[model samples]
Target: MRAAEIRLPGVAPVVVDREVPRAGDGEVVVEVVAAPVTPLDVLCAGGKSYFGVPRTPYVPGVQGVGTVDGRLVWFPTSAGMEPGDGSMAGAAVARRSDLVELPDGVDPVLVAAAGLSAVAAHMAMTWRGELVAGEQVVVLGAGGVVGQAAVQLARLAGARRVVAAARSAEARTRAAAAGADAVVALDTSDHMELVGRFLAACDGAADLVLDPLFGVPAAAAAHTLRAGGRMVTLGASAGRTCPLDAAVLYGRSLRLLGYTNKELTGAQQGEAVGVVAGAVARGELVVAHEVVELGEVTGAWERQEAGVVRGRVVLVP
Candidate 1:
């Protein structure tokens, strides 16, 4: 098997011949069909390691869609505070418990695109955030994988309204396709006016705010929430520090939730995967994934790290 691996921190991944990983008891050996270069993967390539300091000379991918014993499957290769040699290869090994059977009839690329993003979005909204049907939601950074997935999940979960805020027109388009009731462009000339307009479009303040960007966007998102609304902080794409008025939070009876799949237990991972996989089976959610040949892995990593690409980029080994 040929696998693309990071030799060390801050180094470009190289394609090298290696043995196909063997499945241990309660594990499965998968032939990787499509593996996406995610932000996390790019981060690893940059040297700042997570999922532990890469047992050096190992694969870098954190998730992928592939075939296990001829059955379509997908799984989170990054298991905990430690990383696994993931799917940036022709074949890889994965724990059976960490894998989910891909729904029948779904394209492999789409499944690859959805990957951990869908499962994490489902977990945040349903498990950590306690989302309920008929509530209104404001999705910040609605362009990214997790953001887009949240839009679909919120809609499918029956949110009364979904407002999507994206940095570009293309992102807004994708968000709308995912079922946002309204889309707000982040580059609008009038920042506060745009914020006000977004709230108005939702028919008032939102009942829930799905936030990825912090800083100004996070602060603005707080204003969009109705009295007693909840703000779920899933990622900090924008600056980390966000200033807030204590009185405003108290007055509105607002709640702030911080969510991450890394915080979940093994059981929680299974439940979250079930929710997302079920939704995929029903055609309620779609993730845009592009599968490139293994040799194109470097270009894919560059694109993902630069944040210039739309949707997820998968590498087919």
Candidate 2:
């Protein structure tokens, strides 16, 4: 079998030949159909992510869609960022509890491409963020895969208004297409100015904020949340170390919540995946993504790391 092996932390993966994974007693070996290269995978391989790196000489994908003895499933690589191998290979091992069976005939690439990014968006809004129907929701970093998914998921989750914030013109356009009622064009720098711009776009106040971009973006979004509104931080793509205004936090009685798939029980995770997958299978939610051969994992990593590639990028092994 072939895999994108990471022999050194903080370096890119190299395509290498390796033995196929074998199913353990309570695990299933998924014949890799498609896997998405995510920021988590990159951060983990860098040995700097919260979960840290594996012992090395391991595969690096975090989630994927594949089949176990021909039954299609979506599974997470429990070994990713901790130890052992991941889904960035021709075959990967997954605990049975990690597998979520898919509806019949859905596209594996589409499901795989959604991966953890989309799941975070869906769960952050509906579960963690508790976004109420007819409420206003804001998605920071709306140009990225998670942001795009968040925008659409907010609508599907019954948010009456969805506001998307991003720095790129392309992202703004993409956000609108994804079902945002309004799109706030963000500035990469200028924290205060960015805050002002975001506040102005809100018209009044927002009910929930799905924030992936921390730093200035999170702080800015925090101020726009309506009294008692919650802002869920699922990631820190823009940068960590957000500066919260003491006045804003206390004045509005705002709540800042941290979120991750790890917080969910296995059953909760399955339910969450099922909801998102149902919407996806029904075409109620979609995001733009590019497909690449798994053989080109290094180049794909570079492109994804550069942050220039718009939409989800899937690798077919």
Candidate 3:
């Protein structure tokens, strides 16, 4: 089996020939078809994330769609957070509990590229954000794959209005095309200016905020929330530390909730995957991505790490 692995921390993964991983008891050996380069994979290989330092010479894929004994499925890897290799290979050993089998008609590569990210956005709006029909939504970082999924999911979840904020003109255009009722171009360098523009675009009010950019965008979106509104933060794409006015936070009686794919129980994760994959199957959701071969993992990996790519990168093995 040829696998892309990181031999040490703070290094890029390299493709090497290695023995195929064997499944232990209660686990399954999956023949990988498509694996997406995700932030979790990048952060873990860096040896510094909530996942902590990873063991050297481990595979660097967090999730992938594959076939377990001929049944197609998706599985997540916490190798960066644990002691194990992952699915960036010809085959992988996955826990039975973590597998989400796909329907027969679905595209495994598209699911691999879009499923997990869609789950993050879908869960943020429905479960953690507690968004309801007739409520207004503001999606920050609405350009990345997750962000694009969020803009559509927010509308599908019954939001009366959906406003998208992104830094690039292309991103903002993509956001609008993805179903954001309105789009705001957030100035990457000016935090306060970004906040002001978001508020203006949203008409100074919103009921729910699905934030992926935690630093400047988060703080700016905070001020636009209506009194007693809620915000669910899922990632820190722009920056980690966000400054918030105590008065705005306290006086408005707002709620700030944090969510991540790691927090969901196995059953919940599986259920979310089903919903997301079903939406894709029905054309309710679609993800833009570039397909790269296994040998080109280095370039795809670098694209993900640079944080410049606006679409999902699926590695087909």
Candidate 4:
């Protein structure tokens, strides 16, 4: 079997020949099809994440779309989070409990690209944020995979207006393409200026916020929320600590919530993946992504880590 091996921490994986993995009692062997180079994979492989340094000389993929007993499925792997090889190979070993059967006609590469990122967007907005129809939504970091998915999922959930904010012109364009009602640039450091831009774009206060970028953007978006509005944050690409105003929270009685995929049970994760796959099958949800062969893993991994890719990078093995 051929796989991409992370021989060293904080470095790209190299293609190497390895013995095909054997399934254990509770595990199954999946013929890998498509694997995504997610931020979590990069974080874990960096040896700097809270999960701590991972064992080296291992495959580096957190999730992938593959076939188990000839049935198409989406599965997650411990990978860099634990001492094990992942889905970035011709075959991967995954617990049967972790497999989610994908819907018919859904593109494996697309599903792999969206994967947990889309699940986070969907769950954060509906389950954690309690988003309702006819509500206004503001999505921060609207160009990334999670942001792109959140923008469309909000609309699919019947949001009356969806405002998107991103740090780059390209990101803003991608947000617009994802059906955002209005797009705001996070170019300025002036918090009040950003709040003004968001307010102007939203027409009025937003009822919900899908915030992936913390720090300044999250703080600014907080001011755009309506009284009692909810902000569900799932990532901190902008910054770990936000400069949110205490007044904004108390004065408006706003709800600040956090979300993570790990908080969901196997059933919840499976259901969310099914929903996302259904959306993709219906062509109602699409995120920008680039596909490359498994042999190109190094370049794709480097590009993803450097934020040079416009969207998620899927490696087809």
Candidate 5:
């Protein structure tokens, strides 16, 4: 089997030949069709994540779209977070329970690109953020996969308006393409300026906020929320610590919640993946992505880590 191996920590993966993995009890071998180079893959492989330093010379994909027993499915692997080869190869082992059967007619590359990022966005907005129809939404980090998905999913869930904010001009453009009612720049260091921009874009206050970037963006978005509005944060790409005003919480009685895919059961993950896949199949949802051959994993991985890629990078094996 041809696979991308992370031979060293903090290094990009290189294509290498490896033995085909054999599935064990409760596991199956998925003939990987497409695998996404996600941030988790880079973080774990870098040996700097909370997951701790992973065993070296391992495959690094966390999730992929593939087939088992001729049934198309989306599967997850422990990979860089644990001692196992992952879906970045032509064949990878996955627990049967972790497989989510994708909807018919969906593109494998597209589903693989969206993968857990989309799942996180959907789950956070609906389950954790308690988003409701006819309500306004504000999405932070709207350029990333999660943000893009949230922008679209909020509308699908009946949000009256969706406001997006991102730190870069390219990101802002992507957010606009995702159907956000208004796009605001997230590049400012002044909290009040960001809050004012958000307020203006939302035309008042939002009912729900899907926040992936924390730090100033989180604090600013919080100020643009209506009384009792909910903010669900899944990642801290911008900063780990937020400078949220204490008065905002008390004055508005706002809700601040954390979300992670780790908290979801296999059933819950599968259901969310199914929803995302179905939406993609219906042409109602899409995320910007670039597909590269599995052999070019090194360059693709480097590009993604350097933040040069415009969207998710999917490796087709």
Candidate 6:
């Protein structure tokens, strides 16, 4: 078997030749079909992500679609991140319970794209965010995998309107295609004005904000909300800390919630994967994918790290 490993931080992954191991009890060895390179994976590669830095020389992929014992399957949690190998390899071991059976009609490329983004979006919106149907939602950083997925999932979850915020025309178009009611670029001098514009488009105040970019965007989304609105922060792409006004939240009775898939139980992960897979199978949720050969994994990682790629980039091993 061949695998890609992050030999060190701030560098490209190094390909290493190794032998594939057999599956143990309660485990299934998945023949890697496709895996997506995500921002989190990039951060992990650079040793800058909030998740404690992983050991060097370890495979680094969070999720992948594969086949286990002739059954089409995908695993959400990265065995690679937990002191074991990952989907960057030709084969990887997955816990039997953690393996999700992909629907016969779902494409492996799409499943690879959906990967972690779909599960996280589904989990954050339904379980942690308590999203309500007919409520307005503002998705920050609504261009990346998770952001785009959040926009689509919010619509599928029955939100009345979805507002997507990004900084490029291409990103805005992609968000619109994914199902945003309105798209706004966030590079203007006055972001507060932009928030007002989003609220105006929504016909009033927003009810929910699916925020991945914290700091300025979080503050902007906070102000865009109606009384008693909620903003969920799953990623701090902008920065970790932000200047928040207690009075603003207190006066509006607004709530700020933070979420991460790491905190979820196994059953919770299963539920999220099930919902996202079913949605993808039914054609209700679309997963955009860009496939690259396993030999190109290093270049794919560099491109993703440089933010030069659009949609989800999947590695076919």
Candidate 2 ranges beyond 4 A from true positions: none
Worst ten in a row by lDDT for model 5: 197-206
Identify the leading candidate in terms of lDDT. Answer: 4
Q: For residues 97-181, could you state the per-residue lDDT of candidate 2 as single tens digits?
A: 8799998888888887776778889888888888878888889989888998899888887887788998889988888898888
Error of 1 at 199 (Å): 2.0
Estimate the overall C-alpha local distance difference test score of candidate 5: 0.92
C-alpha TM-scores of all predictions: 0.92, 0.94, 0.94, 0.98, 0.98, 0.93
Tens-place lDDT per residue, model 4, 220-282, is 999988899999999888899999999999999999999999999999999999999999989
- Per-candidate Cα lDDT values, in order, are 0.78, 0.85, 0.86, 0.93, 0.92, 0.80
Badly placed stretches (over 4 Å) of model 6 are 48-53, 77-80
Which 10-residue window in model 6 sums to the lowest lDDT? 76-85
Q: What is the overall TM-score of model 6 with all chains considered together?
A: 0.93
**Ten residues in a row with the worst lDDT in model 3?**
187-196
- What is the model-wide C-alpha lDDT for candidate 1? 0.78
CA error at residue 218 for candidate 5, angstroms? 1.4
> What tens digits encode model 1's per-residue C-alpha lDDT throughout 1-317?
88998787666687889988888798888888888888878776565555445557778787878887788887767622255687899988888887777768777777677767887787777777788998888888888889889999988888898888887888888888888888887775444665576766686778888888876677766877778888889888777888666766899999999988778887877676667776777888786667678987777777777778778887888
User: Model 5, residue 114: displacement in angstroms?
Assistant: 0.6
- Itemize residue pairs with steric clashes in candidate 4: none
lDDT of 6 by residue, 1-317 (tens): 88888887768787788788578899888898888888778776676655556677777787888888788898854533556667788988778888878888787878788867878888888788899888888898888788888998999889988998887788777888888888877776365676576666665788888888887767766777888888889988776876566777999999889998889898888778878888788887775568888888888888888889878889887
Shift in Å, residue 80, candidate 2: 3.7
Candidate 6 Cα RMSD (Å): 1.9
Write the candidate numbers in order of decreasing lDDT.
Answer: 4, 5, 3, 2, 6, 1
CA deviation > 4 Å runs, candidate 4: none
Q: What TM-score does candidate 2 get on C-alpha atoms?
A: 0.94
